[model samples]
Target: MSIPLDSPALALRAALHAALVADAALLALLGGPRIHDVPPAEADFPFVALGEAVVADWSTATEAGTEHALTLHVFSRSGGRAEAYAVAEAVAHALHDAPLALAGHRLANLRATTAEVRRESDGRTFHALVRFRAVTEPL
Candidate 1:
Protein backbone atom coordinates (compact mmCIF):
# COMPACT_ATOMS: atom_id res chain seq x y z
CA MET A 1 0.00 0.00 0.00
CA SER A 2 1.25 3.44 -0.91
CA ILE A 3 1.64 5.96 1.85
CA PRO A 4 -0.52 8.99 1.24
CA LEU A 5 1.00 12.39 0.68
CA ASP A 6 -1.06 13.80 3.48
CA SER A 7 -0.26 11.70 6.53
CA PRO A 8 -2.40 11.73 9.60
CA ALA A 9 -0.36 14.42 11.30
CA LEU A 10 -0.10 16.50 8.16
CA ALA A 11 -3.80 16.20 7.50
CA LEU A 12 -4.62 17.22 11.02
CA ARG A 13 -2.36 20.25 10.84
CA ALA A 14 -3.72 21.27 7.47
CA ALA A 15 -7.27 20.95 8.66
CA LEU A 16 -6.51 23.00 11.76
CA HIS A 17 -4.68 25.70 9.80
CA ALA A 18 -7.58 26.05 7.43
CA ALA A 19 -10.14 26.11 10.19
CA LEU A 20 -8.30 28.75 12.23
CA VAL A 21 -7.48 30.99 9.27
CA ALA A 22 -11.06 31.03 8.00
CA ASP A 23 -12.43 31.94 11.40
CA ALA A 24 -13.12 35.64 11.49
CA ALA A 25 -13.45 35.64 15.24
CA LEU A 26 -10.04 34.09 15.62
CA LEU A 27 -8.62 36.63 13.20
CA ALA A 28 -10.18 39.39 15.23
CA LEU A 29 -8.31 38.17 18.27
CA LEU A 30 -5.09 37.45 16.41
CA GLY A 31 -4.90 40.81 14.64
CA GLY A 32 -3.60 39.12 11.49
CA PRO A 33 -0.48 37.35 12.73
CA ARG A 34 1.24 34.33 11.25
CA ILE A 35 0.00 30.83 11.92
CA HIS A 36 2.97 28.67 11.16
CA ASP A 37 3.83 25.00 11.18
CA VAL A 38 7.48 25.99 11.10
CA PRO A 39 7.77 29.42 12.59
CA PRO A 40 10.83 31.49 11.75
CA ALA A 41 13.45 32.66 14.20
CA GLU A 42 11.77 36.04 14.67
CA ALA A 43 8.06 36.32 14.23
CA ASP A 44 6.31 39.35 15.64
CA PHE A 45 4.13 39.32 18.68
CA PRO A 46 0.71 37.63 18.90
CA PHE A 47 1.40 35.00 16.22
CA VAL A 48 0.36 31.38 16.24
CA ALA A 49 2.37 28.24 15.78
CA LEU A 50 1.14 24.75 15.06
CA GLY A 51 3.13 22.64 17.48
CA GLU A 52 3.88 18.92 17.50
CA ALA A 53 1.29 16.30 16.66
CA VAL A 54 1.69 12.85 18.10
CA VAL A 55 -0.01 10.07 16.14
CA ALA A 56 -0.49 6.46 17.04
CA ASP A 57 -2.04 3.51 15.27
CA TRP A 58 -5.68 2.81 15.97
CA SER A 59 -6.75 0.42 13.30
CA THR A 60 -9.84 -1.72 13.31
CA ALA A 61 -10.65 -4.72 11.16
CA THR A 62 -12.94 -2.76 8.96
CA GLU A 63 -11.00 0.52 8.76
CA ALA A 64 -7.59 1.96 9.50
CA GLY A 65 -7.40 4.96 11.77
CA THR A 66 -4.97 7.10 13.71
CA GLU A 67 -5.35 8.86 17.03
CA HIS A 68 -3.81 12.29 16.89
CA ALA A 69 -2.69 14.40 19.81
CA LEU A 70 -2.34 17.90 18.48
CA THR A 71 -1.17 21.13 20.04
CA LEU A 72 -1.60 24.77 19.01
CA HIS A 73 0.56 27.47 20.58
CA VAL A 74 -0.36 31.12 20.84
CA PHE A 75 2.40 33.63 21.58
CA SER A 76 1.51 37.13 22.64
CA ARG A 77 3.76 39.99 23.59
CA SER A 78 0.54 41.86 24.16
CA GLY A 79 1.66 41.42 27.81
CA GLY A 80 -1.20 39.58 29.46
CA ARG A 81 -3.00 36.26 29.37
CA ALA A 82 -6.26 37.91 28.37
CA GLU A 83 -5.45 38.41 24.69
CA ALA A 84 -3.86 35.02 24.42
CA TYR A 85 -6.76 33.39 26.18
CA ALA A 86 -9.22 35.14 23.90
CA VAL A 87 -7.37 33.84 20.87
CA ALA A 88 -7.19 30.42 22.42
CA GLU A 89 -10.90 30.50 23.03
CA ALA A 90 -11.49 31.38 19.43
CA VAL A 91 -9.26 28.50 18.39
CA ALA A 92 -11.13 26.10 20.59
CA HIS A 93 -14.44 27.28 19.23
CA ALA A 94 -13.25 27.01 15.66
CA LEU A 95 -11.78 23.52 16.02
CA HIS A 96 -14.21 21.82 18.32
CA ASP A 97 -16.14 19.27 16.29
CA ALA A 98 -15.06 20.98 13.10
CA PRO A 99 -15.67 19.16 9.84
CA LEU A 100 -12.28 19.20 8.18
CA ALA A 101 -11.54 18.04 4.65
CA LEU A 102 -8.54 15.75 4.63
CA ALA A 103 -6.67 14.95 1.48
CA GLY A 104 -6.32 11.20 1.91
CA HIS A 105 -8.16 10.52 5.12
CA ARG A 106 -11.57 11.07 6.63
CA LEU A 107 -11.78 12.79 9.96
CA ALA A 108 -13.94 10.67 12.19
CA ASN A 109 -14.06 13.25 14.94
CA LEU A 110 -12.11 16.17 16.37
CA ARG A 111 -12.41 17.59 19.85
CA ALA A 112 -10.61 20.06 22.02
CA THR A 113 -9.10 18.18 24.90
CA THR A 114 -7.35 20.82 26.99
CA ALA A 115 -6.17 24.40 27.13
CA GLU A 116 -3.90 26.41 29.40
CA VAL A 117 -2.48 29.92 29.47
CA ARG A 118 0.84 30.80 31.04
CA ARG A 119 3.45 33.51 31.11
CA GLU A 120 6.74 32.90 29.43
CA SER A 121 10.08 33.02 31.25
CA ASP A 122 10.88 36.31 29.55
CA GLY A 123 7.98 37.88 31.41
CA ARG A 124 6.33 39.54 28.45
CA THR A 125 4.99 36.87 26.11
CA PHE A 126 2.01 34.79 27.00
CA HIS A 127 1.86 31.22 25.79
CA ALA A 128 -1.45 29.54 25.33
CA LEU A 129 -1.29 25.82 24.92
CA VAL A 130 -4.31 24.25 23.30
CA ARG A 131 -4.55 20.56 22.69
CA PHE A 132 -6.98 18.41 20.72
CA ARG A 133 -7.77 14.82 20.01
CA ALA A 134 -8.61 13.65 16.52
CA VAL A 135 -9.49 10.34 14.95
CA THR A 136 -9.11 9.73 11.25
CA GLU A 137 -9.51 6.86 8.86
CA PRO A 138 -8.31 6.18 5.38
CA LEU A 139 -10.47 7.59 2.63
Candidate 2:
Protein backbone atom coordinates (compact mmCIF):
# COMPACT_ATOMS: atom_id res chain seq x y z
CA MET A 1 0.00 0.00 0.00
CA SER A 2 1.17 3.47 -0.75
CA ILE A 3 1.36 5.98 2.07
CA PRO A 4 0.14 9.47 1.36
CA LEU A 5 3.06 11.82 0.88
CA ASP A 6 1.82 14.00 3.72
CA SER A 7 0.88 11.15 6.03
CA PRO A 8 4.12 9.25 6.48
CA ALA A 9 4.42 10.77 9.91
CA LEU A 10 1.29 8.94 10.95
CA ALA A 11 2.87 5.63 9.98
CA LEU A 12 6.01 6.52 11.84
CA ARG A 13 4.05 7.43 14.98
CA ALA A 14 2.06 4.22 14.90
CA ALA A 15 5.20 2.14 14.41
CA LEU A 16 6.89 3.82 17.34
CA HIS A 17 3.88 3.54 19.64
CA ALA A 18 3.58 -0.16 18.86
CA ALA A 19 7.27 -0.78 19.42
CA LEU A 20 7.22 0.78 22.90
CA VAL A 21 4.03 -0.94 23.99
CA ALA A 22 5.10 -4.36 22.74
CA ASP A 23 8.44 -4.31 24.46
CA ALA A 24 8.67 -6.88 27.24
CA ALA A 25 10.77 -4.75 29.50
CA LEU A 26 8.39 -1.83 29.21
CA LEU A 27 5.35 -4.00 29.86
CA ALA A 28 7.03 -5.43 32.93
CA LEU A 29 7.27 -1.99 34.40
CA LEU A 30 3.67 -1.05 33.76
CA GLY A 31 2.20 -4.54 34.33
CA GLY A 32 0.57 -4.23 30.89
CA PRO A 33 0.66 -2.02 27.84
CA ARG A 34 -0.49 1.37 29.11
CA ILE A 35 1.45 3.70 26.85
CA HIS A 36 -0.38 6.80 25.76
CA ASP A 37 -0.03 10.30 24.45
CA VAL A 38 -2.81 11.47 26.72
CA PRO A 39 -3.34 9.58 29.93
CA PRO A 40 -6.64 9.26 31.73
CA ALA A 41 -7.30 10.96 35.02
CA GLU A 42 -6.88 7.69 36.88
CA ALA A 43 -3.98 6.42 34.83
CA ASP A 44 -1.62 4.08 36.69
CA PHE A 45 1.97 4.57 37.45
CA PRO A 46 5.01 3.23 35.57
CA PHE A 47 3.17 3.97 32.36
CA VAL A 48 4.85 5.20 29.20
CA ALA A 49 3.44 8.03 27.12
CA LEU A 50 4.41 9.31 23.68
CA GLY A 51 4.31 13.04 24.18
CA GLU A 52 4.94 14.50 20.73
CA ALA A 53 6.67 14.23 17.40
CA VAL A 54 8.21 17.08 15.48
CA VAL A 55 8.75 15.95 11.92
CA ALA A 56 10.46 17.94 9.22
CA ASP A 57 10.04 17.10 5.57
CA TRP A 58 13.46 16.09 4.35
CA SER A 59 12.95 15.05 0.79
CA THR A 60 15.05 14.89 -2.31
CA ALA A 61 13.90 14.16 -5.87
CA THR A 62 14.59 10.49 -5.47
CA GLU A 63 13.36 9.83 -1.92
CA ALA A 64 11.49 11.32 0.99
CA GLY A 65 13.02 11.62 4.40
CA THR A 66 11.75 12.82 7.78
CA GLU A 67 13.71 13.88 10.80
CA HIS A 68 11.66 13.28 13.93
CA ALA A 69 12.03 14.57 17.44
CA LEU A 70 10.13 12.30 19.79
CA THR A 71 9.44 12.61 23.48
CA LEU A 72 8.40 9.89 25.93
CA HIS A 73 7.13 10.32 29.45
CA VAL A 74 7.25 7.78 32.25
CA PHE A 75 5.10 8.20 35.32
CA SER A 76 5.57 6.41 38.60
CA ARG A 77 4.40 6.55 42.20
CA SER A 78 6.76 4.11 43.74
CA GLY A 79 8.44 4.77 47.08
CA GLY A 80 11.58 5.98 45.36
CA ARG A 81 13.01 6.81 41.98
CA ALA A 82 14.16 3.25 41.32
CA GLU A 83 10.92 2.16 39.73
CA ALA A 84 10.68 5.23 37.58
CA TYR A 85 14.32 5.13 36.55
CA ALA A 86 14.07 1.45 35.74
CA VAL A 87 11.08 2.08 33.54
CA ALA A 88 12.90 4.92 31.82
CA GLU A 89 15.92 2.71 31.18
CA ALA A 90 13.71 0.03 29.70
CA VAL A 91 12.12 2.62 27.45
CA ALA A 92 15.48 3.79 26.23
CA HIS A 93 16.54 0.24 25.55
CA ALA A 94 13.34 -0.54 23.69
CA LEU A 95 13.49 2.46 21.38
CA HIS A 96 17.16 3.04 20.75
CA ASP A 97 18.37 1.20 17.66
CA ALA A 98 14.95 -0.37 17.16
CA PRO A 99 14.31 -1.65 13.66
CA LEU A 100 10.77 -0.39 13.25
CA ALA A 101 8.85 -1.45 10.14
CA LEU A 102 7.23 1.87 9.36
CA ALA A 103 4.71 1.60 6.55
CA GLY A 104 5.99 3.13 3.30
CA HIS A 105 9.14 4.25 5.01
CA ARG A 106 12.54 2.90 5.98
CA LEU A 107 13.91 3.63 9.43
CA ALA A 108 17.31 5.18 9.01
CA ASN A 109 18.18 5.58 12.65
CA LEU A 110 16.70 6.07 16.14
CA ARG A 111 18.69 7.18 19.12
CA ALA A 112 18.03 8.40 22.65
CA THR A 113 18.93 12.05 23.14
CA THR A 114 18.34 12.72 26.84
CA ALA A 115 16.38 11.57 29.89
CA GLU A 116 15.56 13.05 33.27
CA VAL A 117 13.91 11.40 36.24
CA ARG A 118 12.66 13.68 38.95
CA ARG A 119 9.99 13.82 41.58
CA GLU A 120 7.09 16.08 40.92
CA SER A 121 6.17 18.96 43.19
CA ASP A 122 3.81 16.73 45.08
CA GLY A 123 6.81 14.62 46.03
CA ARG A 124 4.77 11.52 45.49
CA THR A 125 4.87 11.12 41.75
CA PHE A 126 7.94 10.71 39.60
CA HIS A 127 8.07 12.04 36.08
CA ALA A 128 10.63 10.88 33.59
CA LEU A 129 11.11 12.54 30.26
CA VAL A 130 13.11 10.84 27.56
CA ARG A 131 13.86 12.34 24.19
CA PHE A 132 14.91 10.69 20.93
CA ARG A 133 15.88 11.54 17.37
CA ALA A 134 14.67 9.45 14.44
CA VAL A 135 15.26 9.63 10.70
CA THR A 136 13.10 7.86 8.16
CA GLU A 137 13.42 7.50 4.42
CA PRO A 138 10.66 6.53 2.02
CA LEU A 139 10.81 2.96 0.83
lDDT of 2 by residue, 1-139 (tens): 6757546678778888899888987897799998986898889777888887888887788877889898889999998899888998999999899999988778899999999998999989999999999899877
The lDDT for every candidate, in the order shown, is 0.86, 0.87
The number of residue pairs in model 1 that clash at the backbone is: 0
| lDDT digits (tens) for residues 1-139 of candidate 1 | 5646778778778878988888888887777746888778988668788997888999988878999998999898886788899888888899999999988889999999999999999999899999999999988
Candidates in order, TM-scores: namely 0.92, 0.88
What does candidate 2 score on TM?
0.88
Error of 1 at 36 (Å): 1.1
Q: Which stretches of candidate 2 lie over 4 Å from their true place?
A: 1-6, 60-62
- Which residue pairs collide in model 2, if any? none
Q: Pick the candidate with the highest TM-score.
A: 1
Indicate the worst ten consecutive residues by lDDT in candidate 2: 1-10
